[model samples]
Target: MTVIENIVGRVTVLRGGRYSVEVDVITSSGFGRFAAPVDENPDLYIAEAHRAVSEVDEIIGPELIGFDATEQELIDSYLWEIDGTEDFSHIGANTALAVSVATAKAAASEKNLPLYTYLGGTFTTELPVPILEFASDSEFDYYVMVRDLMEITDVVDAVNGVLSNLKEATVEGYSEATEKASSELGLDVALGLAQKAPMDMEKLLTLVEDNNVAYLKPMGDEELFLELIAGTHGVFIDGEYLFRQKDILDRRYYNALSIKPINLGTLTDLYNLINDAKSERIVPILAEARFESSDEALAHMAVGFRCPAVVLRKDSIAKLNELIRIAEDLGERGRVITFEG
Candidate 1:
């Protein structure tokens, strides 16, 4: 029956001394554990983790005991009811997400199915193309260096050389870097800008045109988003600037949406948002938060949901390695996802 028997949560320390919550969901037939990361003030992250643990021990665990772990949607909805907040403020979003995902993992284990197969059925084989970031001396020179090195040697050595010799350059330089990398690497590579502050419209447009920028995460107003969309040929306006306002997707201002589990509260909520984004013809990108845990469940979710792309940090090796394994397991059935801007 896979009836829930007990639930436990504990504080887990992550890289750079960050704190997160690891949840263990025990059922009649199987068990699952998941660590959902929380990005907070370093001074208060420990307290937040403790609070999430306390919520599981004192509130969520007791309420969810005896429920069927396989009924993922019902259990996830109950998490929201228990929190009694639109934003999961009472129990914390990290706690809700950890419990929701852990329950799914337990059910999948009981059925002896891989997590992606359990969540997405047997036909889920497409893998999202990874957008890797590097800390280089210049924004675009690494692209040129990597391309040239790949021509002389292999990709690994090229990346290694770039990492060993770090330098900085202005974004305005290397206007043709994206085209060169795409041609040389035999894969489409585009520039992604994480715009934190407003810039002059003319200047932003010039940068996009000069650099062949394809993805933009703009922090400006709706006018700026509209300007970029109209001004560029095929630029993808990322919806991450909207943050928690998933409802704003209805406006169709952005061509791509970022899905982060912790921000959305529960697995069902995350799933629903992905579907919603797709309904609007928006490219759904499973993204990593600024401060992430070591959990690889996100990689599974990206595969399960058939996200076209994933915005992952270069140093997030756990997720990267998992994606590699999933690709190998799928063998001939797996292919990298392709989509237009």
Candidate 2:
């Protein structure tokens, strides 16, 4: 007999004669192949996972442990606990995912049928699974660094080196820029300079200064928290100024970014989507979502998203010159603006 751990101890039956249980376990090993071996390790990840499950268990687990797992309302209540909160990293996301799978399995078991039957009676054996080929200059790792980067020079040198290397790796199969001059001439370049590691502002300053680059400013922590709730979009490659747009939903692949004042409707929608995404544990590195404001007046509010961070500016471009000016003026009190918005 399997001696289930105390956390997974009991199940409760609710409506439709279904049952569910809240389970928490300290796994003997970390989950991710990429993140497990980092020098920092998965200490934070595991700790956060444990914390998240524990929080879910403390609330909904006790209430529904002995109740029918198929109680849709009960399940919903469990989901609602973290619905609007952006802090899904440590909540019951993994557990919720497992439970969703379990619910399907249990329903299948009771019906003496396969899991997909609930979706539709027909079962198509094969689905188109995505094959993401991220070719890189070096084998990229997601281990987050705890180091502080403060100088503009360091930022520029590091960003330039990283971008150059990545460009060499990924520029081979690009079909879009095959006719462009530098690209047509076969000069390797980072596609969009998208980075997956920790971003240090000091490093960003350096990159902006060295390259003479202009960029959207990052919303500070306070503004971020607020816009996260209101669902405004805000993000920055190397902060030189703030960017605002009407709506995040309008943002799609390669859509030319427009500088404009974001209105209330778009801001609210952005907030809801981001919160929902966070709750579902679907943090997309290359997507934008809305956030809310933390204060009454949202003058500091903004929008956010992800981009492939290539330094797309050439030395002679006017945009490049503006970026240089801003980078040189770092630490000085002056308003930064770009694109008339």
Candidate 3:
């Protein structure tokens, strides 16, 4: 009978020094690696990491060591049971997600096939358009290295560049720092905003209109979140930033759903959210589901959902390469994506 041979957990820092929980699972046939998301607050994240590490070593490791790894339903049910809380506060959502994903990865690794294939990936040639981000000429130039950039504005000549529009591009102090970088390059690229600060509708709408912001990732109350940016270019619901599930009950309010698997607390919840969004014609974004390692990447990718886009951070080749590899494995060579820092 296939069983978990051993489990190991470690706390590591992700890009920008965010703490994360990394987990590894080994079975007779293969191995798996996964990690939990981190918090920006160092102290809070470190505490969560320590808790996860302790749980794995003292409690979780013993309970599931002899359990069959292939039996996903059984394992996940156990995960739900252990957590008790709907949001997985007890067992730590990050730990639970890491384990669930690692188990799936181990099973796939044993087969020696792509994780997407193992998780029912359909072979298709259709490619999703990728949205590339630009900060400077150097950043823009590097977009081609990624192999699937749609909005790479690396071809800016000095004359046609921002010189003529220098006054417009080089504003005194742009509220949106992201826009400042790309806008300075004078590329015909659209800008997006994450309104972390609260604002009235008039002010928010005017900001969107004046800046010609292409999308809004609002962070605040449900009513205000929707009010500030809905029906604009596109409204993407970022639970990490926005933090309300009930806010998305209405289908017409927003057209895109973005999430991290860790934030959802379980694979089941993540899939349910994706399916619901798809049914309602809302774009399902596997965006910001930051799987730091290859195993986490495959486990999440193998769910067999061809998303509208998956956001990739522009920090490391490892991250970008992993994303590209997942897309290729799923026969989705060009998954729609927007670059973020």
**Per-structure clash totals for the candidates:** 3, 47, 0
Best by TM-score: 1
Model 2 poorest 10 in a row by lDDT = 30-39
User: Which structure is stronger by TM-score: 1 or 2?
Assistant: 1
User: All candidates' lDDT scores?
Assistant: 0.74, 0.28, 0.55
Best by lDDT: 1
TM per candidate: 0.88, 0.32, 0.73
Q: What TM-score does candidate 2 reach?
A: 0.32
For model 1, which pairs clash? 137-167, 137-168, 138-169
Off by over 4 Å in 2: 1-45, 56-58, 71-74, 82-92, 120-126, 137-168, 173-247, 251-341
126-216, model 3: which lDDT tens digit per residue? 2333333223331111111122244222322211232333443321122233334345654433444445455677766666667635446
